[model samples]
Target chain A: MYAFFIRTFEGSKTQVELLKEKIRQDGKVLSEEVLKVDSFLNHQIDPVLMQEIGKEFVARFSDQNITKIVTIESSGIAPATMAGLILGVPVVFARKRKSLTLTDHLYSAKVHSFTKNESNDISVSKDFISNEDTVLLIDDFLANGQAALGLIDIAEQAGAKIAGVGIVIEKAFQPGGELIRKAGIRLESLAELQSLQDGKVQFVGEEAF
Target chain B: MYAFFIRTFEGSKTQVELLKEKIRQDGKVLSEEVLKVDSFLNHQIDPVLMQEIGKEFVARFSDQNITKIVTIESSGIAPATMAGLILGVPVVFARKRKSLTLTDHLYSAKVHSFTKNESNDISVSKDFISNEDTVLLIDDFLANGQAALGLIDIAEQAGAKIAGVGIVIEKAFQPGGELIRKAGIRLESLAELQSLQDGKVQFVGEEAF
Candidate 1:
């Protein structure tokens, strides 16, 4: 699938490498015991890098004519909004919890967070997405593919076509990449981590680990 | 205070008018009920417009060196992230709900949402904000000022300095604009609403509506 996108002048290998290099340089480990890059992913949104990633996603799926970019909010809004800017599309973020402001007619699905170790409800406003629209799902990270699956569920409920799913980083060794591949949806990731050992970041197809 | 910022940059008035015009033109009403401006605010983050707003913010507070841009989750992230980008600073968004991935050590505050019609908790990671940081609070709306106060409380809990607050829209008739002003803090709003009556948008000044 990546080969297809790359061959069609839709994707760039060099830009992906640049994002990986940025993740290595600016991303810092928040805790020694728990290896989490809080600076980039959790705490702050790096606009410069995020904008580049957004551009890459737009280039990769430029021909799709996406009507809306759907994402699970809190962290995903940053990159999703960036992608929406480049794609010139509206972005509808799923709320993690139900609120009075949210309409009763919502498409909801349960998402399990591996890092958080809990399951939460994710939902979208039904009016924002429609059967005539095509959606491109964006997220910050894909470890177990649960969040992506939850987003796909919402998209399906709204009867919107899934153009593709763009992820900033994917843990290749985890079940996420394989599960997404088996689901038959187009998945494009900027960085793939083959392994993590001794608090070091290792890339796929590399002997760095 | 706005005059001070306006005097620093002469031509910014044109850009401000441009934004106000964009809001009036692109903004749509859903069934004459909800103001659905998802194209620019909630769903899509307009890069050009957001950049202009960010520039206006920088021009408004150029004298102060903002160490961090603090905001709440959801709608606030877009404008805050854009401002952080132009200011070349990091943006720290307060989580509306507690997640398992977040550490227990946090600065928490309560926020009442008029749109949502409920009160919820907002928090910031202790590690992201510190005592020495100077925070510039940013939000998409300042209708009631509860959200801004929530962020300010979080910043205060971290012992961070409150440089000032930047808001995209403020309902002048509401107590929000008045409360923030009485608190003796500099409040800068891109657009001030005199009122919303008969499904029409009204501006506070003759600048634009």
Candidate 2:
């Protein structure tokens, strides 16, 4: 039993390391605050890598009893759907609209995009989520956490229980990570970047390597 | 050999029928031209159904020497990603931008959304697609064919070979299907809607039922 446990843990570790290696190879540092992974994670997606990512998310949140997977539209859809496939749950993506105010028959929240410097209303249809749901929130990147907070707000508006927030990449230096943990929400990030300064990636636990 | 062919054909037909049934059951017709599949297609996604879709796209487009899968942002990402997972190809989604004119370092095309009554420039980084790639274009809906044309335009701009176009649902009454076919492009739509008059869906071949 001990041997089996060790093997499983090692396997998990290797899979996650594969993701980090990909980020190291193909990921480009655009600026001190911006890292471009458009070739794989967002714009051009590697399906095999995304499959591994889904498996990793399932392994981490296996104990959460998640009923549904929620994410924001466009980039978040691929990873969220992959996780939903493994979890056997439906995935819902909040639509970003140009509207600044609430609309009828929708659970809405205003989310500001720091990168784009714009505020847009993100909304989910009222018919999809309800109070009975226990949802797992997923996104590609966690920077300022504005999008995550918006999803959480919508879930709260619908009275749905949040299992946790799963992020593929987290800027460890950003206030978003600290703010989420302080709120007592279980947050799991596959990769945590300590810094993106000087056109380099310094992952938060890389000193051990 | 005969039985094997029959079995494969029957299996493919049943899977396509499943998608049509889902639309007939949950699809809401807001008007003559609008069908809301928010419950399972765009806003909320059914992973199991999407898996079947992925398999089906592979089955149909297996003959095309497809090296890449191209799709538009938002709705098309889920199904396109699933297809990419099966085909072992990288999926690239065209990011919709507000810019009207061509931009630097990207292949851009103007696509007008008839549903929203607006125009947006869809772009893909020049680094993603090249002359060596034989790309299969996929989308959730084919109405006016503007988006599909935009993708084809971008692919041509990148000098990529066009393998084919795959669509989840096609409005048969609309001119998009005819326009694409007239251009000598192979267009495969899983479900075709003949009419949605009086809030009732009429699939093109439903009379056989």
Candidate 3:
């Protein structure tokens, strides 16, 4: 059994610290490269805690008039939906596979998952977002930024203005953080992990949360 | 654009009636066999409407002392997470595809999606549920009972008590409702559709909800 309350950072009291604590305690680290939060956030979810993560995202991006929040299918839907609830906005997730029921008119983009070693097309209905909409993109983890870029591509296709991006955990060790910042997208990550050294999780921008 | 009623169902009569109204108005019928609620529920999610759906679910299953709300990954995560928020319990979704980070210890099940015309292995981390758990399964739609049956099987594998089955929409024309009811599962669907015929959605037990 995983002891979920083990705090890694003794004095760091930010949401980032608490989140890192949860990861260190409950997250299953299959390898030095793969840190799975399936026990708490993705596969096995803690909604009450995730809802707090949502409020934290809103707290960070409250100044922006985010009319809609968009995320990719599967894991992102949980926290992003919660953020939509806290923000009083709607949430739309891009479908990874085209369903028989989905309409033909859609904004499609290609996303390559570095972790999965696979590439696929993700799409959103053309009618869900429009030119007037200001959308915030949110996701569970940002590693390679392929999925977030796909979301950005879809939002731009709909002519919607990019409000910002919210990420639950950012692997700053990867290119996602760099690419997003390089693109000038206003991105806020609740917990940013700098490295996983000898089964220990390190952090970036500790004071910024 | 999909018109999201900026009213987060506030001052709305009740979740059931509001959900039905939204379905009647915004739900699309691509064919007699296909009824798509992508505009509001599945594809483009309305957080306020979904939150109310969660509350209505809790009202239905409140007395059961549900320990965990279980769902399949992807679309089910949205409403299930909200229900967890309302119930103040944790949520767990079975993963459709095994990722590298997933643990080898798991309860596996095969689910055939009637919509997708594909069958794959869906598994949940064995640690997520146990013999003491009373699990409640929630999903976006119940047409074949195949998916829910898979979940039930997984719960049973964990020796967890079956609290009940909750569905957002049930295609009554299909055998899913009867099979679940016949098994004596306390099956509750917010909206039960009798048929989707001639570009129309017919409902059974409408007034009861």
Candidate with best lDDT? 2
Local accuracy of candidate 1 as per-residue lDDT tens digits, B91-207: 888877633345488888878877768788888888889999989999888878898888878888899988899998777777887788787778999877666666666678664
Which residue pairs collide in model 3, if any?
none
True contacts kept of each: 0.49, 0.88, 0.88
Give the number of the best model, judged by DockQ.
Answer: 2
Native A-B contacts reproduced, model 1: 0.49
The positional error of residue B201 in candidate 3, measured at the CA in angstroms, is: 1.8
Show where candidate 2 strays beyond 4 Å.
A1-13, A100-102, A207-209, B1-13, B100-102
Q: Between which residue pairs do clashes occur in model 1?
A: A91-B43
Name the runs in model 3 displaced over 4 angstroms. Answer: A1-14, A98-103, A205-209, B1-8, B98-103, B205-209
For each candidate in the order shown, give its overall lDDT on alpha carbons: 0.75, 0.86, 0.81
lDDT per residue, candidate 1, A8-121, as tens digits?
A: 112554668767776678655343223355676667666656666777888898889898888878788877876776665677788786333444878888888777788888
Candidate 1, which segments miss by more than 4 Å at Cα? Answer: A1-14, A25-35, A98-105, A114-117, B1-15, B22-36, B43-48, B98-104, B114-118, B206-209
lDDT value, candidate 1, whole model: 0.75
* Per-residue lDDT over A88-129 for candidate 2, one digit per residue giving the tens place of the 0 to 100 score: 799999999888455889999999988879999999999999
**C-alpha lDDT of residue B204 in model 1:** 85
